[model samples]
Target: MHLPNGIFMLQRVQTVYMIVAMLCIGALYLWFPSVEDAAGIAVIERSEPLVFGLIFASIALAVISILTYKKRQLQFVLNRLNIILNFVLLGVFVYRSLTLSGETLVSEKGIGVLLPIISIVFLVLANKAIKRDEDLVKSVDRLR
Candidate 1:
């Protein structure tokens, strides 16, 4: 599809950041292992409703933000929401790992816990870029 002149989503730095953050969240679903049961089998699968819902929400937010690039304020708002979601995801990971019965030590926690943190960082960067662009627009508007 031909994007109109300068409106291509991929042309924006924040869009790239958002896409990366989404990918990281996706990776978290696939790579991160859930708490293991007494039989040593992972209790939660990526397909689990709760886990899948959060991941889907995160990816959807990123995509919606990217599509709303023409509306900088809306994009910024969406990015902020996405960051909050990532924080929630991280908290869930922490709570799950810590509350597991009889499980101790840091090594048992899967690398999945870090994915939300990574997603948060990238979302923050995207928000910063969006803010920068918004500032530039406002300054230019003032000059007119």
Candidate 2:
């Protein structure tokens, strides 16, 4: 029932959740197209500099978080930071979708718009798992 140092991290549920969240973010980069103009060209394309920056930043954070699994406290903090970043991304999506000067800003709502929500859900699950593991460790310490 006892796993050696680094091996224990591989068995943690939170790691799986983080990986899933990363996959969702990657999907956002590959398949989620943003707003379209009158002629049907995408205005805020996912490949645009600003959009790419936000997406890559999120991906990097998630990757760093996964690699920091040994430090539960740091992992928890990173997950929280990632969640906040996802919220900001979601806010941007909302802003882009809303009407501006009596004209709808977004001509199409793609799966990319929902990526943040999906990523948030996965991150929350990861955090919950991490908390559970921490509680278990604390209780074990009290027993000794």
- Candidate 1 TM-score, C-alpha based: 0.85
Clash-forming residue pairs, model 2: none
What TM-score does candidate 2 get on C-alpha atoms? 0.84
RMSD of 1: 2.8
Residue lDDT tens for model 2, 42-125: 656676676687778889989999888878899999999999988888888778667433255436666778888999999999
Query: Which residue pairs in candidate 1 have backbone atoms (N, alpha carbon, C) closer than 3 angstroms, thus clashing?
Result: none
- Estimated TM-score for each candidate: 0.85, 0.84
Clashes of each: 0, 0
Error of 1 at 22 (Å): 0.5
Off by over 4 Å in 2: 1-8, 37-40, 99-106
Query: Which ten residues in a row are the worst by lDDT in model 2?
Result: 99-108
